[model samples]
Target chain A: MLPMFSGKLCQCLSVTRFPSILFLGVIYVAYVLVGGLIFWKLEGCSCITNKYSLLAITVLKMIKAASLSGLSPDSNDTADGFWKFTSSSVFAATVVTTIGYGNIIPLTTAGQIFCVLFALFGIPLNVVILNRVGKYMLAIERNFSLKMMWWVLTFLYFVVPMLLFKEYEGWSYAEAIYYCFITLSTIGFGDYVADHNPAINYPEWYSCLMAAWIFFGLAWLALLINHSIDLLESVNAYMRRRKNAQTQV
Target chain B: MLPMFSGKLCQCLSVTRFPSILFLGVIYVAYVLVGGLIFWKLEGCSCITNKYSLLAITVLKMIKAASLSGLSPDSNDTADGFWKFTSSSVFAATVVTTIGYGNIIPLTTAGQIFCVLFALFGIPLNVVILNRVGKYMLAIERNFSLKMMWWVLTFLYFVVPMLLFKEYEGWSYAEAIYYCFITLSTIGFGDYVADHNPAINYPEWYSCLMAAWIFFGLAWLALLINHSIDLLESVNAYMRRRKNAQTQV
Candidate 1:
């Protein structure tokens, strides 16, 4: 099994991964060089005012803060009460998925950079997680009725948040479901970004909280989508088997 | 058959189409309202200057112009002898996929806007298209032959441009491929945007062309990814069929 896995990995690296990496690296260097030149040229274009400079600095600072915050793993593990929720599989999936709805962006430049790096890493990590989830879903299908399990799992994970969103956000039930679907899909149109409520004066903390919520929610949805796909495959397989058996008979 | 098609259409409308339209409508209204308020507030802010305002206007105008130019569907139909080599199906695929390497783009605001809209429409449209392509691919598959087809498709669509990008743009072959992949993916890390070469120095037209090319290219790449996913689904279905047949036997 190890040999097989390693062989497949080697093939993947040689065929797709290495080439892609090299290609990206070259493009990135060229882009940086060209972008630097453009910025240099534009620097003297009389449009680079002190205010614009300040805004640029602030944006950079914000990005830095977010990155640093992301690198240091969530400290929610230390808390006993409500913090227990953070340790849930749902939360774990969220962080790994990176559906980070700006409600919970980094507060420091280092943190922001870490957050970006984490997101880059998290995309592939989520794919791995989804694969695991897919296996579990397949197991569930074999042990019980696929439809029943799907409904039960989806209700436990998806319907609950959908209801909570409707109530907490004062959204219509349909809109809540829509939000859930959109957020989970990562199409993030930013129509319903969290932590924008004027009531939430602590924007930074609020943003973080919202981001955490979105991340988990999205991960759960991704798992659900994977499971659904697996179930479809299983059903298709079942049908093919019956057809073959009938032919044999 | 008509009834069935209509029923499917109705179901689609109810589930996806209508909701998307409604969602976009709500978003647009909210955007205008919120954007208006923000603009109004910013207008009152003492930090804003006439020059900054002018720059913002210029940027908006440029974007608008590009969009409009892209929408001019009649423009590219007039075959200029200069671009005969770049007008092949494969090259069209390349341009639409955005492996441009500063070789092509629109030269008007109208063109740019059209390109932007085309991209906006094309990404989702291509998803549906690739789903169909996947079905065709599965039907054509015959064991080892299938793998060869995948490689051939990848080489034709991906590798060739990679080589060309390196030779034409002074990029390493790897970087060229990376640029193609990234641009195609619409990740648009904004690292390597198009620059006007001396031969194509009409600034307005050049910018528009770049916009259009990027839009189309990104869409094509997305379509390819979708196609790959569909292929995976087909393989999974095949595996499931075999597994079930074995179990039943």
Candidate 2:
């Protein structure tokens, strides 16, 4: 129940500090608390992480019970074997982008320390990489029709990969497209990871190539979005000036 | 092992495709694979999630053994108690910002679905939020000294929180600053969580408020970083033009 007009016009003009904090408090409850609860209810059913509290399931029947209820899965159900080559490539992509899906994270003390240091170097390096590629792409963009560029981008990053994933892993088209969007946007929910299974024999070179593809793809998306934003801001400025001119009349 | 000099000469070069894809492939190897390995070796020690192979230890003893080692703790070691207010706040913050630091991810099928939908709404809303706040901040920035504003931002977002976290959670100053940097920059490695401890009796309201603080903090950082990049690009463009003019002379 936010007033949406809490600025300048306070309910109690002399005492607004408490109200500001109170407003934040309200947002926390209405937004975070409720949202978390919904997720908790939804995700708790399949959670294998809470094994300690589920004292009802005996050790003898644990495996039998877990399989019967698709919800009781080991955290390693989709684990990248901690260091398998293909999944490791995916891990590297997520970290550099700052998306860090945490699907398969550092498991050792040394690993944690390394993650911090590598991310420190990798994060900035990634930005430089994005900026470099973006500069080149934007320059070349002028020579080609914008629609044609988008068509290529869509086919190369989305349609093509979606088909490959569908064929390679049997994921539906929507799931593959969703994965591409999530990864490129750096949302990286870590749900639809590809070739993470230890049973699969995904090529190391393929994973290596995938990393570059993900980075370049992200840079292109950023360029398009940035261009749109610039256009939007200019239009806004033009509209504002026109309104101001009318007001003067 | 990227040559990084494929530009200028490649505009007229035959078969330019190899150089382009090759550059990205190189980045994938030097950046992702090597970085992933370093993290694996460093963080693998405390990775309690790799329990299947360590079968000599019983499940109950495994928990105890891992707890004693401090490095082999469960993934839910500081879980948000399935939706406890504070952890949930952390969870919500991670998702919307696309940090998705699977430190405390939803384990249920339903939760994952909710997360996808929530992110669709939340990510866009977050950007709109940053845009709206950025507009106001930019207006104010025009009137104020850049250094002063930066100082204020530093103290408000980083310094104050660092101090409070140190006091409240007994974390070192460096740790607090690290957490602030990781979370605000949206890297969110999830190695050093604040209230993930079950031993503590932190209030739910406090955690809820923490989420709002984190969101606003990230938005401010984004605005500041965006401004800096814009300034940097303009300077770079000016310098390049001067260099080109000198060549003509």
Best by TM-score: 2
Q: What is model 1's DockQ versus the real complex?
A: 0.04
Instruction: Give all TM-scores, in the order shown.
Output: 0.33, 0.55
- Looking at candidate 1 chain B, the ten consecutive residues that score lowest on lDDT are B81-90
lDDT of each: 0.41, 0.55
- For residues B222-243, write the lDDT of model 2, one tens digit per residue: 7766765566456555765676
Candidate 2, which CAPRI tier?
incorrect
Shift in Å, residue B185, candidate 1: 3.7
Every prediction: chain A TM-score:
0.42, 0.62
